[model samples]
Target: MLSDFLHEYFLKLSIIVAVFGGAFLGIGIGLVMRAGAALDGIEVLALYTLKRTSFTITEIILGINIIIFSFAALKFGIETSLYSVLTYFAATKTIDYVVEGIQAYTGVTIISAKSEEIKHQLVNNLGRGITVYKGERGFLPGKFDVSADCDIIYTVVMRLEMRKLKNLIYEIDSEAFVFANTIKEASGGIIKSRVKH
Candidate 1:
C-alpha cells in the first residue's frame, strides 16, 4: 500500500514527505478544479453548504477541515496529527497559489505632478495600458480651500515587474505617490504584451 511504502521509506523524514506530498496533491486538485471538475466529495459538500448558508466556500471548507483534523487528532497520535495538519496547511496554500496563478498580478496607482511624462513612459517602456482619472490634488490642512487638477494613473502589472515599475516611476517623478494592491484576478485588458515571433 502507498501508506506502508511511505512509512517504510520516509518515516524518519515524515515532515518533508508530508509537505511534498501535500503540495503535489494540491497541484493536482487545483488543476482539476480550474478545469471545471470536482476532485472529491468535500468540494461538492462545500458547494451545497454555500447555497444554504451565509458562509463562503473557503469558510465552509475550513470548517470541514477543522472537524476532520480534530477527529484525526483524537484517533491518531498527536505527532501524526500535527504532521497531518502541516500537510493540510501546505496543501491549502498550494491550492490557492495554483488556482489563482503563479504569475500574480498587482494593481498599481500613481499620483504625480508629471503624470503626462509618466504615462507616456509607462506605455512606451512597460507596454502596459493605463487608465487615467481626473482628480484634485493639494488637499492639505491649510490648502484644503485651494486645489489643483491632476491625473491619477492606474495600471495592472505582474508581480515580478513591480520593482522595475517602481524604479521607472520614481525616476520620472521622485515625488510621485505610488501604491499597489494585490489583485486576485485580472482579465479582459491589455495585460499581456503583444509579442512577435
Candidate 2:
C-alpha cells in the first residue's frame, strides 16, 4: 500500500512538473530571443509586423499571443488555453528586457534622381557616412524618371533617430524614394553599433 501511494504521488508530481516545465521552457525561449537579437517561432510574426505595419510592437506581440491562446483552446482544450495564456504573460516581460537591452538600428536605402543632394544632406546634417550603388530605377509607375542616372543611397542609423532622419529626408526632397529596415545583425563597412543597447 505504501509503494502504491508513492507511485501515485510521483505520477502527480511528474504531471505538475510537466505543466510548469513547459511554461519555463517558453520563458527561456523568450529570454534567449530577448538576448540574442532575433525572434524564434511566433515572435517572428511580431517582428515582421513591427517593421511592416503601423501597429505598435507591443500590440502586435499581445495580439499574436491572444491568437495563439485562442487557437490552443479551440484545438486542444480549455486547459491548454489557460496554460498558453499564463505562459505568454510570463514570457512577455522578456520583451521589455529585449527592447531595452538590444540596440535599435535602421538601414536607410534611397533611390533618387537627386541622390547627390540627398547624400550631401545625409552626410553634413546627419553626420553619417553613406554608400552609393549604381542601379536602375522606375519599375514602379510613379517612380519612373525620378532619377535619370540611378544611384542607390544607403545608410545606417540608430532606431531612436530614424523618425527624425525620415522627416529630414522628406523635408529635403519629397520625391525621393526611401526604404527603411530594422537591422538585427549589421557588420562590415561604416555601420557600427553595439550588439545591445
Candidate 3:
C-alpha cells in the first residue's frame, strides 16, 4: 500500500511539472510582468532579444513555441503539435492583450514625381520628417527604357497615422508608388512631433 501511494504521487508530480513547466516556459516570454516577478532564463532571453533586436516579443515566443511543438510532434503525435500551436497562439494573444498592449508601427515608403509637394505636405501638414534616398526608378523589367531619377521618401509612423498619411500622399500625387511594412519598433528619430499641427 505504501509503495503504491509513493508511485502514484511521483507520477502525478512528474505530470504536473511537465505540463506547467512547458506552459510557463512557452508563454512567459515577455519578462518582468505585473505580478511582481523578475524574469529568468527563457523569459529574460526573449525580453532581451526583443529590446536589442528587431524581432518582437510575440515573434520570439512563436519561434520558441514552434521549436517545442516540433519536438512534441515528433515524440508524441500530430494532435499534440496542433493542440500546442493553438494553445500558444491563444495564450500569447490573451496574455499580450492583458499584460502588454500591441505595439503597432508602420514604415512608409513613397516614390513620387512631385517630391517637393509631398515633402512639403509631410513636413508642414503632417509634421513628419522623411529620409530621401536618391535612386533611379521606372526601369521596367519587360522594357529596355532607361531609369528615371527619383527620391525615395521613407518614414516610420504609428499605424494610426498611416491612413491619414496615405490620403495625403494620394491627394498630392495620384501616381505615387507607396508601400508600407509593419515594423517592430522605432526610435531615435522625429517619429512624431510633440507639438501637434
**Backbone clashes per model, in order?**
0, 1, 0
Return whichever of 1 and 3 wins on TM-score: 1
A best-first ranking of the candidates according to their TM-score comes to 1, 3, 2
Model 3 ranges with Cα > 4 A deviation: 1-41, 45-55, 74-76, 91-103, 194-197
Which segments of model 2 are wrong by more than 4 Å?
A: 1-102, 139-147, 192-197
TM-score of each model, in listed order: 0.71, 0.52, 0.64
Which candidate, 1 or 3, would have the higher lDDT against the true structure?
Answer: 1
Model 1 deviation from the true structure expressed as Cα RMSD, one decimal place: 5.9
Q: Point to the candidate with the largest TM-score.
A: 1
Q: Please name the candidate that would achieve the greatest lDDT relative to the true structure.
A: 1
lDDT of each: 0.82, 0.70, 0.73
- Residue 27 deviation, candidate 3, in Å? 9.8
lDDT of 2 by residue, 81-179 (tens): 776665555545455435544456788898877778788887777777789899877566776665455889999987777787788878878888889
CA lDDT for candidate 1: 0.82
RMSD of each: 5.9, 12.9, 9.3
lDDT of 3 by residue, 1-197 (tens): 99999989986775565556545644564334535343555456667787788776656766787888899899899766866676666555555544444446788999998988998888888888789999878666887576788989998777778889999999988989999997755778787754473
Candidate 1, residue 67: the lDDT equals 78
Model 1, range 1-197, lDDT digits (tens) per residue? Answer: 99998887787688788899888877887787668677788878977886899764445765787778878888887788778777767776777677767678999999999999999988887888999999989766886878889999999998888999999999989999999987876889789754333
